[model samples]
Structure formats: C-alpha cells, structure tokens
Target: MESDKIIESILNDFNSFNIDDIPNIDLYMDQVTTYLNNKFEGSKRNDDDKLLTKTMINNYAKSRLLPPPEKKKYSKDHLILLMMIFYLKNIISINDIDTALSPLIKDYFNDGNNSLEEIFKLFIQYMKDTDDNQSIIDAYVKSNEYFSNLDNEDNKEYLQTLTLIATLTYECLSRKMIIEKLIDSLPKEENSKDKSDKNKSDKNKTDK
Candidate 1:
C-alpha cells in the first residue's frame, strides 16, 4: 500500500482501550499477552507483529520497567504500566520510561486515588481531544505530497522514504525534548534520591 493510504487507513481505524475496556481480573502471563494482542489487533500490519511476548514481559520486569507480577498474575496496574511502556518505548529509551513512570508507580500503583488506570484514561482522552492521529495523517500527507512534486521519477520511492524518515525524525525529537524537560522538572529530592539509592543497592548486589 502507498504510505499515505496506509496512514489514512490507520488513522481512520485508530482504536485503543479505555480504562473500563481493560479486563479487571488478574491475568496470568499468557492471558496478559493475549489481551494486549487483542487490543492492538487493528494496528498490526501482519500476524507476526506481536505486541507482547513472554520474553519481553520478563525483560520488562528484569529491567524494572514493570513491577513484578504477583504469583505469576498481572494486576490491572501492571497491565496499564505495560501499555504505557509499549507506546513510550517506541519513541524513548527504557531509562526515560523509568524516569517518567517511577513517580506515578510510587504514588498510585495500587492506591485507589489517582490510580494508573485513571491516569491512563485521562491521557487517552487528552490525546483524543488533541486529534493527534489527524495531526500525524496531515503531516504524512503533506510530506508525501511535497516529495511527489520533485522531478525525479527514478528516485521517487527513495525520496518518499526520505520524506517519511524526516517527518518521523522531527516528530520524535520534538516530543523527546518536551519529555526530557518534564523529567528534569520532576522533584529532584524525591526521584533523584530514590534513583541514587537504587543504584547503590544494585552496585552492592553486584559486589556481593
């Protein structure tokens, strides 16, 4: 499919789970994977495009991107965290994901007030209000059109690919800069101190 057509189709059918849409019951590893796959079915380009794998889940836990599951079952909060990591990892490093999500996990992991699910819902709604998908489609369409006009028929595909790459580069970098600023603005005494303590603990374990 042409890039513009693909973008239009994806935007037209863009769908994500609302807070209420997520399963409330604690799910085992396989179930969690299946649920996430189902939620992302519309976005997948092919059957091989798996959203979550057992190895990935284990790696997330090992890297502290996800809190450890209880008795091999993932709670609603864990699922939400995984969902956040899925999207953020596409544009940022795991370290950045840790920095961005640490405070939220600390404050609201299992607590009823200001829960992760609630925050996720708010973010989804905010994205919807901002018409982010439309913005993406417009950007892709504009870039594609701009590149199409150049008199290089032989290099048209290459130029179109470059245009998409340029668009993605700008979008990723712009968003990353804002995210870095936000991370820097977080309360240093709390987050920084916690990070230092964790590092010390890890080093001690390594030395042991």
Candidate 2:
C-alpha cells in the first residue's frame, strides 16, 4: 500500500513539468543556472544540491555539447538543449552525448525547418506515448508477491528490494544499449557534406 501510494505520487508528478514551461526570453548565465535549478528542484536528492551551475554550463560549452550563447545570453533553444543534456549525462558519457546530438544541433540550433522547441515537444510526446506506467506498477506488485512463503521477513524484504532494483537496472541497461546503437547509426560523413554544401551555397550567394 505504501509502495502503491509512492508510485502513484511519482506518476502524478511526471508530467507536471514540461518543455513548454521554459522561458522564451534569452537569459544570462546566472539566470540560466537559477532557472534550471528551480525548474529541476524535484530531481535533487537534497535541498543543497544544484541541478545546474555556471561552472557546469561553461564546461558543456567548452565541450561543444551546447551551442555558444549569443552575446553571452542563452536563448530558449539553448535551454532545451541543456535540458536534454542534463538527462542524458546521467546515462551516457559526455563524448557520446556530443556524438549523439551533433546532427540535432547542426539542423536545429538557432535556425532550421523545425524549431528546437517543436522537436523537443515531439520527443516528449513520443516518450509519453510509449511509456507503460502499468508495467511499473505490475513489477512492484510482483516483487512483493515473490518470496511470500519465506519464513524470514527480513530476508524476504531484502530479496524483494533487490528484485525491484535489478528489474529497473536491467531496463535501464537495455535502453542504454538501444541509445548506443542509435548513436552509432547516425550519419557521420553526411554532416560534413551538408556543412560543405551550405558553405558553397553561401559563397555563391555572396558572389552574386
């Protein structure tokens, strides 16, 4: 019953925050950090933990995982990218993030057929559509059902917790593998060719 209540609470909070909530105005670095910290406060393990900091933002910029701010101010698009990067960094290495996001950044940063907001909105929708909340609840229920006949309550509880942890870990690992494969499947040379073509087009326009 406690687990059910906790799970329901988590599920209820899931969609409380959305990408549309990000501010449209360009923000200074301090403003960006404050906004992120406030927006992702629920993600923090403790009150003292900050979700984002100036130093982390600077490192991300230096790593080129984030596009440089215009006149030292970050746009809405920048915030979208940072939000993605924040979630991604927990699962994958920074280098992998750069590799995976290269195409997205090239096509949608600042200017593109689809705005970054639209793309991110679609992504969130897809996730929401695909996630099965019932499956999670079922897993928790099954964990409790297991080892029900065991005489030792302490051992039963420990095993049940371990079972739940293992289940979640396996699911995370499976998804991580899929992400790695998707990153590998991304076009490596096409990005360079596209850049070259754009450069040539600009040159021709300038000449004319």
Candidate 3:
C-alpha cells in the first residue's frame, strides 16, 4: 500500500484507551496482559500477535522501566507506565525512557496531586486535539513534491521509498538528539536521587 494511504487508514482507525476506560482496581499479571491486548487489538499486525506478556512485564520491572507491582498485582499507575513505555519503546531507548519519565514517576506515581493517571489523561486529550495525522500527510506530500524532479518513472516508487526512509530517519535522529541534550541539562542530583530510589524500591521488592 502507498505510505500515505496506510497512514490515513491508521489515523482513521486509531484506537487508544481513555482514563475512564481503564479499570480502577488492581489486576493480576494475566489480567494486565489481557487488558493491554484488548486495548491494542486494532494496532496488531496479526490475530495471533500478543500485545503484552508476562516475561516482558517482568523484564520491564527488572530493568526499572516500570515500578514493581504490589503483592503481584499491578495498579493503575503501573498500567500507565506500561502504556507510556509501549509507545516510546518503538522510537526511543529504554535508558532514555527512564531518564525522561523518572521525574514524573518519582513525583506523581502514587500521589493524589499531579498523579500519573491525570498526566496520562492529559496526553490522551492532547493527542485527540492535535492534527498529527494531517501534519504527517503534509510532510509526506511536501517530501514527494521535493523529489518530483526524478525523471525515471520506472524507479520512482523505489526512489520514493528510499526518500521516505531517509527523511524519517533524519527526523528521528534530530528529535533524539534534542531529547538527549535536554536530559543532560537536568540537575545531576535529581537524576541520582531517582536512581537511588529506584534501586531501593527494587531491592525492597526482591527482599519481600
């Protein structure tokens, strides 16, 4: 399929979980897997694809990408963390995700004020309001226009594919560099505290 058409189809059928749609009660590992699978059903490439797995959740906790579940039950905070990781892992490193989200999680993971749930809801609303799909279409259109001078009609599709790949890679690299610079600008003490607390929390969970 043409890239633009595929992108349009995705935007038309984009499905994501709302804050109210997530369950209020804590869920066991299997339930968490089931919930994520259902929420991501529309985006899956195949019917047999698994959205989340027990092993992956365990790895996330072990890597400190997410907080440890209480009593083997995941809370809404955990769910929110997982959702953030799910989207980000495609384009960013796990270490970068840790650095980017550590402050938010440290301050708001379990707090009533400025909670992660609220933040997640805000993001959902922002996405709903944003013309991201149109922006993507415009970008693709502009890129094709810029490359329209290619006279070889037979290889136009191949060249267009290469151009798209190069453009997307450059875009990702630019954003990643900016994010890394911002992360480096954060106070060293704050980063240290976050790592220390994460280690302490992980150890306490293991010792229990």
Q: Please give, for residues 126-191, the per-residue lDDT of candidate 1 as tens digits.
A: 877988776676776676677687787757767776777788788889988998888778765344
Give me the candidate number with maximum lDDT: 2
lDDT of 2 by residue, 29-95 (tens): 9999989988777677678986889999998887667888999999999999999999899898887
Clash pairs for candidate 2 = none
lDDT of each: 0.80, 0.84, 0.80
Instruction: Please give the lDDT score for candidate 1.
Output: 0.80
Model 3, 1-208: lDDT tens per residue? 3877766667776634467888899999999999987877777888988777899999988876688899999999999888888877777777777778888888999788778888888888888888566666666777678768888864776677667777777878998888788877875534544768989999999999
Off by over 4 Å in 1: 42-50, 144-161, 189-208
lDDT order of candidates, top first? 2, 1, 3
Task: Give the Å shift of residue 68 in candidate 3.
Answer: 1.7
Per-candidate TM-score against the hidden true structure: 0.77, 0.82, 0.76
| Model 1 quality (TM-score) | 0.77
Which regions in candidate 3 have their CA more than 4 angstroms from the true location? Answer: 13-17, 42-51, 144-154, 189-208
